[model samples]
Target: MLNRVKRFADKTPFSLTTPNPQEYTLFNQAILYGVLIEPYFTKIHIKHLHAIIIDGYKLFLSLLVGIVNELYGKLVNSGKEQLIWVTKEMIDVSATRIDSLLVCLMRQIVGGDFSNGNLWLCFELVSLCLSKWDCLLQEKPVVLTSALYTFLRLLADHCRVSNNLKPMMLRQMEIEFFVKMLRDQFQLCLKIGRDLFHVPF
Candidate 1:
């Protein structure tokens, strides 16, 4: 599948004239689908995408946001894993609108839903924020503010199920995330002040 898309992309003239925007978008869409669906060949597919990429991954990132927004709940487990992995990769490279992608993923964490999948999403995202704290603070501090609000709300819900082992673990992680944000980025947390009072004690 990737090879066929590569062939189609290669045949499209890019240097002689501006590549057709519609065709370029189609190529990116096909590559994004391949990356999500073909786990075994993910690295090779990403490499292929990098080799042919003309837009610094803007279109690719947009397609990912679309999938997260429209099809995240129905995605298979492996596909979800790949989605998270690829999102981290995009972050590492500082893809455009990356904060929007992170915001979309954060919104997918359904409140009051203690399902494993939902908790897993929460864990992955919180961990991502923790691990990438400095980078995010520099590139897009607003994302952390959004995360702070989302997790504070989630923490309130997570507290209700603290007896369960999974929620307990997740709650602990959430605490660590909050501490790090407040300890290191106090002013940013301060911006969320009045809203903090609204979250139940």
Candidate 2:
């Protein structure tokens, strides 16, 4: 994956500071990010994960958040990441993967082919967690507990109670628990409560 990115880079003659033309916006960034990090979720290494997250993770996450915010601003006034709330057209039937569909849906939300978020990062974390949900819940359960609780909160916020939110909420629970595990791993150890993490603030 990195090799493919390098090939693209070689052709463009641009620095990492320059977002790859393939990553002009949130939607494009999703494809590149998905191609690069999605594969590593199966068996992630701390060192490599560190490189991926810290290298430009902030920029990536911020971009995804920006996309969500853009959609919220343009379509819905709720100021939350609600697919149906932003664009009812998100409910489409397709054989494509959910994450890929998320990319496309986001593009549509931004209106006229636009997406500017780090959705792939979120997808990577959620997918990884779901893959190990049971084990993580039993083993590294403390953080998983926190993550799941938060996931539930997000589910409640997104679900209107009018729609059948249970299934989606359950899936999100798995993904959220996964995110919590990853978060407790080391992603936010540096940026979070530095004192709690035993780092000088």
Candidate 3:
């Protein structure tokens, strides 16, 4: 099935399906299920996929994020962790491919009705990101930064509820560790730049 889908994607002429109203839905579902079944996202560039969509990047991103949230919900809600461990692994791999998924989602989800829609998705992603911070920082530093920045930006924008949520979020993020990490990286960058431009003393 996977091979067939790939072949179809690769061989089909874009013009033929260009006008189909359901094309984006079909593509989104196929990609979502493919990722769930075999974890095939690690090698693909999300931007490339975004370019192939008929409906525009916003709709594509919305569908992608919706599936991602669905995936997270299923993984967390499933009773047997041992059996569902592979599902978690798949989710992690997909994250590596599109490191900015959650960050990008912030733009897609901001607004008046965000509580159940965008806010909920952002909360789920922030929780997952905090839980996996150490590993994500080591393997995908950009993703970690993007996720943290997005969460912080949201807090700044929504002062009322964010004030109550700030302490919990900071605790989960291990504020001290993150601050130290940022300082260390900043110092390293400065040292590198200074050494590069240094003159004989």
lDDT of each: 0.83, 0.36, 0.45
Question: What does candidate 3 score on TM?
Answer: 0.41
Kindly give the number of clashing pairs for every candidate. 0, 6, 0
Candidate 2 lDDT, tens digit per residue, 55-153?
A: 334343344445544543453322233332211111121111223333333333221111233232233334544655555444444433344433343
Writing each residue's lDDT as its tens digit, candidate 3 over 1-201 gives 566556435433333335355665555444444444443442242323444565434454454555545554454333222213322343454433444445444454463333444455555556666566666666666665555445545544444343445334533443433354456444432433333233111
What count of clashes does model 3 give?
0
Q: Rank candidates, lDDT, best first.
A: 1, 3, 2
Per-residue lDDT over 101-197 for candidate 1, one digit per residue giving the tens place of the 0 to 100 score: 9999999999999999999999999999988888899988989999999999999998888578988898888888887887888888878878756
- Evaluated with TM-score, which candidate comes out highest? 1
Misplaced by over 4 Å in model 2 are: 1-55, 72-128, 132-146, 153-201
Cα error, candidate 2, residue 176 (Å): 11
Worst ten in a row by lDDT for model 1: 9-18
The C-alpha TM-scores of every prediction are 0.87, 0.26, 0.41
**Residue-level lDDT for 107 in candidate 2:** 36
RMSD of each: 3.4, 14.7, 12.2
Check candidate 2 and list the clashing pairs.
Answer: 26-115, 26-116, 63-117, 64-117, 64-118, 129-178
Better of 1 and 3 by TM-score: 1
